[model samples]
Target chain A: MAQIRMETNLLGANDMLAAKNRRIFKARGLLVINLMSSPGSGKTTLLEKTIEALRGRIELGVIEGDLYTDQDAMRIENKGVEVVQINTEGTCHLDAGMIEKAWSRLEHLPIQLLFIENVGNLVCPAEFDLGEDIRVVVLSTTEGHDKVLKYPLVFQQAQVVVLNKIDLLPYTDFDLNAFNRDLQLVNPQIRVFQLSGRTGEGLAQWTEWLVEEVGKRVI
Target chain B: MHEMSLIAEMMNMVRESAAHNNITRISRIKLVVGKLTMAMPHSLRFAFHTMARDGLFQGTELLIEEREVAYQCCQCGEKYLPDMPYGQLCPNCGSKASHLLSGRELFVEYYEGDSGKGEENGANTHGN
Candidate 1:
């Protein structure tokens, strides 16, 4: 029997493409954000609010990843932003390769802030890095506070968390203290913005932070 | 599950290596998976079996080495192992500035296979 030593990463190909994407974004001075969440976490609504708040101020573009339909992409496009849709068919996550293919179509557009709305999956999407400047996870109050502990990887890797559906916080049993404590344990440095997409409450803070990020990335 | 895709990538790597070294009928494959990867070993094993049904990977045994989440406290400069991904706070100094050192490993370490010229009955034909 012959033993062949091949110590290599399983996601080496994906990581390499991610590095390439990072380089491209850096050269273009584009602030890329990978938005992740569960299916019903109000990610699309958050994007729509962000677009309304930052439109004409920052050149914004979006790449929407969905399982089959381009519903989210149409929503973003209706907000007057150039949106590209990538239907992964049945894949749960958007890898670097998919992002690369999507970005090629949007590279010519005047985009300074690019948001890649990843497939609404907390697990698989966290494993594949799409070479974004920031990783944001949107968690709704309806999703429960235990999500941080149940899916620690997604929270641990995220730089920011948008606590969406805050207007419904009074209606649900989502404990804010427990959520903050769990998130603190998982990611101590994570910045969180509590906002409701339906009512547009507490959205200025989120959009302001995004504008600041885009400003910092601009040359 | 995404484990199927992970196994498919592993098979691609194994096939390339086998072609390069002229290995046939791979018998053993070793993998290192970290706890922070969130990839369950049982699921990975099931994926391997389902994907390796035929071809050069048929009848292969998979060996997995699971690694715990390791972190280093940035403030106190102390190394520690967290029981869970959320338990990353430094125990010695109660600091939250913990940097993950080695917990996200997911890789194929090595594999053992038989060359067509080697002994068929597990006899040591090549020098160890």
Candidate 2:
């Protein structure tokens, strides 16, 4: 009985820290997005294309979370945007404390849009809150249509779902209508976009929606 | 995996609680995980069993309580749990304005432990 009370108190502490981080982000008037997807789902590719599309419009900064290496961070930096790499040292997801540390390195940058690319895992990353304005999940058609159903938590928690690699839909047996139906079943209100990062087809709608969302936050 | 880290966090919480309460051993642990968390109960149990070894909760039994997703309709101000996945329309008022109220929590609710052993009969009690 007493032990349970104490455990509750401990989680309370962590939740309080999460709330504090959220409050800080809200005060800054910055739009923070926690981007999550499976490995090789074109997360970095989509990000690159987004940067190119919205570069002049939005002042963007990125915080890349990975198990090891600064490869993703380097990729984002090559786009001439401010980026921070947080190597989790084998940890699967980025928690509030890790984001807090990364924020210190990015606090000085004149950033309006902050994107945190979470480690490539569908399950664990959805569990942690990193003080983001939205939680966006990316799914590539090459990964199969069953992804949304298999990992319902990510889709359920996400505010937006980006279906990348649509160019390969003809080569693969990926079903767009079925995928959208499953996504709607899990999260009806979630905004989903179908696009091919390689061909730059169907990306404009997503970027335009993102620009509008950022605009609303900026004003 | 992230389950390992979460188990480590759970162990720390158990240890801190046992120490604070001056309890020696944790007999059982109770945790509530929301369905939306999507944590595999088996995986979490496996992780906890492996990580809890040689710790304060060496022989503790982890009891996990699962909760379903519930939402409150923002328009009609009605609270209800949806059975179908992605059913945004309220059953009563047919309002699409609904917001998630719970089902994302992952926390250790409490633990049970024996305080001390009795002198003669060796029965568990609050103190020796």
Candidate 3:
């Protein structure tokens, strides 16, 4: 028997769909963001705050990925943005095909930005690309500094790292300097925004950065 | 786990390639897994063993190779191996290089299987 040489990516099918989604997004001049983080990292709250900040500056739509209910989708809908909820049942992450289906609902909404809030898991979500223009990983200050080092794969791919719940830093042992150093090791050029979803401290910097990113891609 | 789904795809690939190349039974399969991925070998093996019980793929030997993460220096334009397994520091120029040369891969490399022209022992699909 001879050895057949074939280099086949296991995620090739999903990646093909992701490429198609990217092309579709580009043709429509829309920017999609895949927001990821661990459970209890306050990603929903961060999105709420972000939606409030960019209400009039840029039109927004969201596709919320969760295992069970449409809780986050409801939260996003309360912010006056069109939202779609995808229940993965028990899947740990969201794939490009899910986004492809979700986009159909918001296809004619005249929105400029789409946020795919991936299921709250650090490991699996990083493995799949959902045809997003930007990837952001939200890590709250209470999660500790070792998260950047432990979950390097997720942090490395993120263009922006959101350090939320800074207002609670006083009660937690989370070290910002150490966290930055770890993040630098993973990705030296990662843009970091230290903010609080509850107190709104440092929200302006994050919102300004978001607006700038949208402005850069809006055609 | 995602590995389960990925392994299912790998099995499909093996079958399709076998049917295309006129092979009946695949005996050995080789896969290259990256260091940055969260796939544990045991999990993949379990998934493979459990799924290979089907008629298309049975008792297939799976070989997995773990790859190390490498980074390319942006300053000196050189690719140097880092001291540790997962850091992005450029060992050559000591710069904060953003280009990741390797270590985000998960793919099937090679496989050996039963071809046609013999006594047609389970390889009759080849139609020799």
Scored by DockQ, the top model is 1
Docking category for candidate 3? acceptable
- In angstroms, give how far residue A190 of model 2 lies from its true place: 0.9
Question: What does candidate 3's lDDT look like per residue over B18-118, in tens digits?
Answer: 78877777788999988788787888999899889865467689999988777778788878666744777776667876477777779988887776454
Q: What tens digits encode model 1's per-residue C-alpha lDDT throughout A81-140?
A: 999999988888899999999999999998999999999988889989889999999999
| Residue B42 in candidate 1, Cα distance off native in Å | 1.8
Q: How much TM-score does chain B earn in each model?
A: 0.86, 0.80, 0.81
lDDT of 3 by residue, A71-160 (tens): 899999999999999999988889999999999999989888899999998888999999999999999988899988888899888999
Deviation (Å) of A3 in candidate 3 = 2.8
Which 10 consecutive residues of model 2 chain A have the lowest summed lDDT?
Answer: A1-10
The segments of candidate 1 whose C-alpha lies over 4 angstroms from its true place after superposition are B83-85, B119-128
Interface C-alpha RMSD per candidate, 1 decimal: 4.7, 6.4, 5.8
Model 2 C-alpha lDDT per residue in residues B1-128, reported as the tens digit of each score = 66777778888777765666666767887888777777667888999888887746777898988888888888888888876653555788877678877777788776777554421322222321
- Ranking of predictions according to DockQ: 1, 3, 2
Winner on lDDT between 1 and 2 is: 1
Candidate ordering by TM-score (highest first): 1, 3, 2
